[model samples]
Structure formats: C-alpha cells, structure tokens
Target: MAAKWQVVREMDANLIDTALVEAAYANPALRALFPLVSHGSLQFSRCTRFPWSQDLPSIFPYDGERHFRVRRLHEPRGSGREQIGGAVTADEAVELVASHLPPGCGPALDGTPDDLESLS
Candidate 1:
C-alpha cells in the first residue's frame, strides 16, 4: 500500500488531552515520532511532518473522538514524505519543544555543524 504523510502545521496544545499522555508515551512508536511534530512549529505555515497512515485518528481518537481534530497539512511531495508525528505525552512536552530549536550558527553554541542537534 502507498504511504500517507500529514504535514502538521502546529502542535495544538489544546488538542493534546492530559488523560492520554501516558498511553501515548508508553507506545515506542509514539515516543519516537513526537519530535517530528514539534519541528518547525514557530509558525502555522512551518509544516511539521506527521504520520497518519494507520487510521490513527479512528484507533486513538483525540478527546471525544469526534471533537478533536488534527489539522491535516498539505504535502508537496508526489506521494508523501512519511508519517513522523503522534500524540505527545505530558512528560515529553519539555523535551519535544527543545528538540525543534533553530540551528546554531556561532562557535560559542557548539562544535562543528555535524555536532549540532537543533533541527533549524
């Protein structure tokens, strides 16, 4: 089957219900994918890539399963870029935000470009 990629515009703090944070974190896939959701979230048009191939919304509906809506983003890629985001747990929020920082340019920040961790 063909892959489906969702270009996430922003991380809706409101859409993220507190009750399901732990469940999301428990799943290894969800934890690994949270970072991508946080990337380039400074602006709406920034486009944070996410994975929505597995009927995630139907399986793990947010909030009331009908009220919660994750704004689906447009992908310029011919088919898809690949699903990269998911329901972020509360504890992962801090780390999630930090991982999406702008890239470094000065020497004081860190070593070579290869050593940098920020996504830019």
Candidate 2:
C-alpha cells in the first residue's frame, strides 16, 4: 500500500494560492495533482482526489509574511497531519509543495528554461 504521508509548511495564503494556480497552469500534470484550489481569510488549500482513499491529498498554507507554516493533510487510518517544510517566499513554498507530492505524482516546474537552468 502507498505510505500515507503529508507535507506541511507555512507561508502567505495569497502567495501560496497564486503559486499553486500558476504552477498548475504551467504544468498540466499538476492540474491532476491539485484539481481544487480554495482560499479563506486565514488559510489556502489545494487538493486532489486519490484512488486509494476517499480523502483527497490536501495542501494548506497558513498566513504569515516572512515566515509561515504549511501543512499536508493525510488520512492514515484517520485524519492526520504532518509538517514537511517551510518557506520564506512564495517560490520556495511552491517548490516544497512540488517536492512533497504523493508518490507517482512527478515533479512540477513553473518557470522557463532559463529560469530553471539558473536554479541548477
């Protein structure tokens, strides 16, 4: 069975939402990984349905400016949560989200070749 896992971190809600949307638009695969995106006054979430379980994979970003907490919701028998990483910028938060995607879900890049190359 797939390991029930979650990646959590904290960052600006708006920043995370925009990053998730932009990433999905840039990479169609991510659309499958994160089909639903929602935002509230205090938090933002991106979620996708999984075949193994009824509960979908969820990514949540808590409100903050320089430093924030983000959490990945997992259903390991029951509702569970984990902290995977944190970020100082929206880009970093997005990278963390991409890196922690459930098994089988591949990497996601939201920048041009030059931009990606520079990071390498």
> Which candidate gets the maximum TM-score versus the true structure?
2
Residue pairs with backbone atoms closer than 3 Å in model 1 (clashes):
50-84, 51-83, 51-84
Which residues of candidate 1, in runs, are more than 4 Å off?
1-16, 35-67, 76-120
Model 1, span 6-58: residue lDDT tens: 22222354544333343334434343332222321211112223222211111
Q: How many clashing pairs in candidate 2?
A: 9
Worst 10 residues of 1 by lDDT: 1-10
TM-score of 2: 0.44
> All candidates' TM-scores?
0.25, 0.44
lDDT of candidate model 2 versus the reference: 0.40
Q: Quote model 1's TM-score.
A: 0.25
Candidate 2 lDDT score at position 91: 47
For all predictions, the C-alpha RMSD in Å is 13.4, 12.8
